[model samples]
Target: MVVTMLRLRKAVTNLTQPQFIEGYRKAQLIDVREPKDFEAGHILGARNIPYSQFRQRFKEIRPDKPVYLYDQNGGKSARAALFLRKKGYGQLFHLQGGFRLWTGKVKSK
Candidate 1:
């Protein structure tokens, strides 16, 4: 389990706010926070695929594209990235400080 966790950590890249902002537009932006949090405020264009349901819905994200994951902070995104890596999805990245640190524009439902 430890070995697998290490491998997953290395497989996903952690991007700073600026870097995330720079690349997220071209990647598949995913918000792993719960639906309530996602609906309150989320990065513009991000799709809510809450970590609680990630396993069942990860396939909704295309493997052909880069995947950017984030939550209120970074923990959930990190785990989500690990799950995606194990599932053979590459081009995985996450916001270093997650959504709360994001100074970029957001959309609320």
Candidate 2:
């Protein structure tokens, strides 16, 4: 497994919206946005574990599958990815361009 911090270019990441959506049912799709931002709108099926609480709640996240994170602008999600890496999360991915670039049919309730 990846045991060290690896910086990946957003373009090089092997994650796509369709792939993420399909994998959502089988993997963990986490929204690292604030509670208020999450309440506003977020990807369907995404669980809120705001960035602030992620470190403390790391144990709650599964390490066996990929974890996808997305924020309003992508910055927070990237931060989440970095945090996860430092926490030994090997399978982490950030939504390219974040939720703002999501044009899929999935909607937040």
Query: Top TM-score: which candidate number?
Result: 1
Per-residue lDDT tens digits for candidate 1, residues 1-109, read: 8896687669799899988888989999999999999999999999999999999999999998999999998988998998888888989998998888888898998
- Candidate 2: 10-residue stretch with minimal lDDT: 3-12
Residue 3 of model 2, lDDT score: 34
Clashing pairs in 1: none
Query: Candidate 2: deviation at residue 4, Å?
Result: 13
Model 1 regions lying over 4 Å from their true place: 1-5
Model 2, residue 30: distance off in Å is 0.4
lDDT of each: 0.91, 0.73
Using all chains and alpha carbons, the TM-scores for the candidates as numbered come to 0.92, 0.78
Q: Give the TM-score (vs. native) of candidate 1.
A: 0.92
Off by over 4 Å in 2: 1-14, 105-109
